[model samples]
Target chain A: MIGIVDHGMGNLMSVRNAFEYIGAEAKVCREPGELAGADLLVLPGVGAFGDCMRNLRHRNFVAALDEMVIGSGIPILGICLGMQAMAKRSFEGGEHEGLGWLDADVVRIRPAGREYRVPHIGWNDVTFEGNNPLFADLPADPVFYFVHSYHVQCRNSGDLAATCDYGGTVTAAVRKGNIFGTQFHPEKSQDQGLRILENFVRQGGQC
Target chain B: MLKKRLIPKLQMKKSRFGNRMVLVTTVRFDEVMEIGDPVSQAKIYQAQAADELVFLDLDASVENREPVTDYIRRAAEELFMPLTAGGGVKTLDHFRMLLENGADKVSINTAAVENPELITRAYEAFGAQCVVVAIDYRQDADGREKVWIRGGRTGTGLDPAEWAEKAERLGAGEILLTSIDRDGTREGLDLETTRRVADAVTIPVITSGGCGLACHFSEGFLTGKADAVSAGTYFCFKDENPMQTRSQIRNAGIPIRIQT
Candidate 1:
């Protein structure tokens, strides 16, 4: 079973609906026991980074999730802000600790120059860098929906699976063994985004 | 590079005393507007390959009402992509409220032309990234297209080209030009009118009204010189045939959100 972690921060409906749409049995669970029973876990979020982490920790989900996924090595997928929370820390407020699943930090995307739009809101192509089960059948540059101001800066550059150019080279997708993350929204990204989720599901939580 | 956007516009109408009126005018919808829930309809559009979603509260203008807070809040909470809300936007507060509710942008029509000052006010308040000027127009006796105000009933007497230039100068990031003659007709985009206004300004121009076939979208971008094309009927008729239209556009190589 695919369990979507719901802590009242991220968008849970669309994510649940997407998994259900793909003919996969998924449940949005706030309880740690429900999460432990699932074969794969999905951590979905929207809103501020600090608030999401606070909710995860306050609800005792952070520890439970770490025990189930990182401790036992259960396959996990994090989308958008959920992915950001997997990093070491986020600069959204001051210095907020993250899940520390990946050796990365969340930093604001520098505007680079004048007339550069922040919160890069729209479609951008994803270019895969390594062979991964998540991107198995997808094209080299499949369009994905993105709406973010801050981006992930991987502590280990080799862990990066895909990258996209916004104002400059921005991390689009990351994979470190069983832990995976995407800055763009696959639920909102139509076919390309759905295909990515479909590929992830097809892997049977094995990464 | 940005792809040409295809939007499906839904107008918000409310009935007071059982008289259904357009959100922007006192005149009633011919058959009383039955506004489909914006959240559900927007998701339907997203599923049917709509590039973006636009909602205009038609009754807001006639009733001295602002953009419906509950509607905008619900829409912003549910919609996945950038949402553009129109109608009853008269000041910066209205724009801020809509944005705060989850609107990616606000479309201003009569207020920008009538008050004029509201244009820069919204531009400064929300920045050019979130402001879109909606120009409803029709051809005059001299065959020159003229802008319309007050729900496409009252004539503004402003030339389309000049009005577009003024809007761009006022810090509008984009323009939605709807040809009244072609509205609901589905003939094709008014290429000459679209080209004229598109050439008059540097901001992206979204051509509305008269999108019958996939070719119309391609022509709107290539021939009409429009940056985006929007249609309502083609998408709303989901029971009959929706994929046919999407496939045709895709076969034509027009950039749109592909449904897999």
Candidate 2:
């Protein structure tokens, strides 16, 4: 079972519906106690980094998340801001500490030129980096929906999974052992994104 | 690099005293034309491989919030593409409700002009990416473009380019710039104003109101420099669907998502 952790942020329905659309049994697990029975965990968010961490701790989800992700080593996937919440720190709206899952930071996208535009809205292509399972069988032209101003900057190069050219090469996806993350939204990315989600569900979070 | 988008604009309204949401279109912001069911039309667009869909609630009155959300929730369930909804969004609760229900972004027109502070507040809460400031304007007899409110009935006397700059400064992620004069005209997009506003702001700009020929879509990107171009009547009244239009745009050397 894929349990979508509800940290009180973003569009959870789209994510849940995307999973259900692909014939996967997924539930929006709202309660922290409900996290034990799931084979895989999906952290989805679209709000501020600080608020997401606060919500997880306030809703008593941090301890449950630590138990599952660290103790039992359950496969986990984070989307958009949920990916940033896995980082060590973020400099958006002031400095804030993150969940420390990956050695990374969330910072504003400073385009090389003023004409490059911020927020990086709309569909952009991402090229898979390593032999990660997340890119299994995706189309050669893989484009996903992106709408974020802050992007993930990974400290460790080994965690990089995919990248997209904005003003420069922006980290689009990352994977570290059982932890997987995508800066762009697979739920909103249509067929290519659905294929990636299916890959995430099929693999055991291993490269 | 982000690919240019080709979005279908669905002008939706509930039938008088009825619960069904009917998809409608506008010509120069005056004559109203009924299209079809919004949900069914959305499916066609999804099948046609549209990049995204925009739902504009014409009757965005406070009394109509309930039915408006019902239609949004229904459409969001059937379509997995990114949906940006707008019309009469006044407060932060509206943003929360739409996002919770499934809208990836919400556009504000009169509400943003009436209360510019709401843009900053919505940004502080939901982040700038979800907050879209919809700017509708009309060119006068003297070739001056001023912002229009209340479905283009009332005039704000504000310059579209200047207002776009203020909107971006106030934390809006994108600008949905619509030219009331060219809406449904089929002549072409208002490249003059589209270029002005697109150059004024550093954020992405979506130019609406004048997409007729296949070349118009490419013009909006190449000449107008808009990040995206949207058309309602052109797609509704004409045989040009998103796939055909996307090929035309891509053939003109614009990097848009390939048709699946």
Candidate 3:
């Protein structure tokens, strides 16, 4: 079973629906105790980085999440703002501390010397950097829906798994061992997105 | 790279069956023509790998009712692509209701005009990326672009270019510019007006109405400078789907997503 951590931030139903569509038993886990029965976890969020962090801490999910993802070594996936929360800190509204699971920082995407717009909305191609189980059985450079102004900047290049170009190289996906994060919303990316969620569920059992 | 988008606009109305929502095609925001069921059509679009889907509740504004949240939830369950729901969104609560019901984005037209602060408020609550301001406009006898509200029933006397610029400054992530003149005419998009609004705003602009052929989509991207093109009549009236439309646009030398 997969437990989607719902900390009162973004739409958790969409993520849960996607998992159900792929024939996986996924439940919206709103409390820390709900994480005990699940072997796989998903942290899904939207809205500002600071607000999401505040809500997570308010719901007391930080410690439970760390225990499940780090202490237990359970495979986890973060989507969009949830992915950014894996970083050390963010500069969205102001400097706010993150989970620091991945050695990265979140900052606004600044397209240098171009007419590229912020909040890089709509569908864009994501070029895979290395072979990862998250993108297994997917076509080369599949398109995903992106809606954000800030992206993760990984301090360690080895953690970077994929990227999408928007005037500059924007961090699209990252993975470190059992921990995975994708800046795009797989639940909103259609067939390509369903394939991604299916791969994550399948790989979680192996981990 | 972010490729240009080909969007299929689906209008929703209370079905004659009484409780369900059915797909309706409108000409200049009136003269509705029933197409089919919204949920089934949305599934077909999802299978075709449509870039995004727009669901506008046609009766919401005219009937003075809230958007069909039930219909939106039904469609979102079967769709994986981004969904934008609009029509009769007047308050921040309305925006919240739609977002909570699986709408990835909410398009505001009537309310945003009556209260410009609604756009900013929605943007503040949900990030700018979630707020889409739909501006329905037509040229007056003097050839000046005037903004239309209440589903093009009344004119706001605001220029489309100026209103678009203000909308961007107010934190609208995208602008859905629909041309009332060419809407349902099946001639082509009003490239000149689309260009005017697209040039005024830095954010992505989606041009709607007056799309008869796939070439009109290309023209909207190439000549009109629109970031995306939305069509309703062309896709519903003709025996075509978004896949074939995308292929035609791709063959016209415009880059579009062809999901394998």
Candidate 4:
């Protein structure tokens, strides 16, 4: 079973609906104990980075996620703010510590010039950096729905899986071993987004 | 690069023939004409991989009824793209209910205008990404662009460009700008007004109303500089769907995501 970690932050329903649409047996796991049977985990989130971390801590999900993702090597994927929360820290709404799963930090996206808009809300293309199971069989460059002001900046360039040009080259997708995250909304990206989600589910077993 | 979005604007109302939900279009926000069923048309757009879908509940606010959440839920089940539901969004609970029922975004027009603070509250609660402030605007007899509320029946005398700036400052993630003068006219969008509002705000602007042909969409993006273009009567009454429209727009040299 694919367990979607629900700490009361993300659009869990849409994520669950997407998984179900693709014939994946996924459930919203609110309690940490509910994630015991799942081989793959999806950490979905939205809203502020500080509030999200506070909620995770309030629900005691930090330690549980660390065990499943780091200790036991269970593969996990984070979406939007969920992806941002995987970084070491974020400056959104003041400095906030993240899961520290990947060697990256979340910072507000800066517009290159007057032509670019903040929040970067729209469908943008994701250009893959290197081979990763999460993007297997997908388009060379797939467009995904993005709605955020901050983006993840990877410390190690090798961990970067894909990048999208908003103002400049912005990190779109990241993958380091069993952990994966996307700055865009795969569930809302139509066929391209579904393909990415489907690929993630297909890779669940191998991980 | 972010591809320009081609969105189908479906106006919802009780079918004149029966109780089933149907698609409708209005001229100057009146003279409603039933065209087809929203669910079937939405599925067709979904199959064509339209960038997004916007459903405006025409009767919700005017009739003082809740948004057609059931229709939204039904459509969301089959459609995988981003769904934006608008009209009659009065409170944060309305926003919550819609998001919970499968809408990716909730757009408020009249409520957001009457109580601007609602935008801030909703944005603070759900994050700025999910809140959309839709503005219905038309030039008055004196030729001043003014914002309209309550299904465009009441003119607020507010400058659309200024209101768009305020909405963005209030944390609205997007602005859905509809031109009342061009709605259902098929003359093309009010490019001048659209350009003005789009230029005034930093957030993405979706221009709706007065979309006659596929070329109008390209004009909205290329000339009007809108982030997205929404069509109502053009897609409803004409022989064009999102597929044909997208083809025409893509042929105009704007990159759009083609569904394989």
Best by DockQ: 2
Q: lDDT per residue, candidate 4, B133-252, as tens digits?
A: 999989889989999998888889999999999999999999999999899998998889889998998888999889888899999998899989998888775588788888888899
Error of 3 at A126 (Å): 1.4
- Residues B1-260, model 2: lDDT tens digits: 68999999998877765677788988888788888888889889999998999998877643436326766788788787889989879889999888888999999988899999999999888888899999999988788999998888788999999999999999998999999999988889999899999999999999999788989989999999999998898888658899988988888988999844
lDDT string, candidate 3, A48-157, tens digits: 88888888999899999998888888999999999999999999988999999999999999986435777788788999988898898888769998999999999999
Candidate 1 chain B worst ten-residue window by lDDT:
B21-30
- Point out the worst 10-residue segment of candidate 1 chain A by lDDT: A113-122
What is the lDDT for B83 in model 3?
88
Measured with C-alpha atoms, the lDDT of residue B231 in candidate 3 is: 88
lDDT of 1 by residue, B58-138 (tens): 657767776676665665444556578889899888886776565667899989889887888776554565778999888
Candidate 2 off by > 4 Å: A204-207, B61-67
TM-score of 3: 0.97
- Candidate 3's displacement at residue A162, Å, is 0.5
- Candidate 4 chain A worst ten-residue window by lDDT: A134-143
Backbone clashes (count) for model 4:
0
State residue A45's C-alpha deviation in candidate 1, in Å: 1.1
lDDT of 1 by residue, A1-207 (tens): 998998765457667766777778889888777775788889987667887888898878988988877777788889988999999999985889999988999998775653344545556667888887887777655877776778899989888988887558899889988888898888767767777888888756453
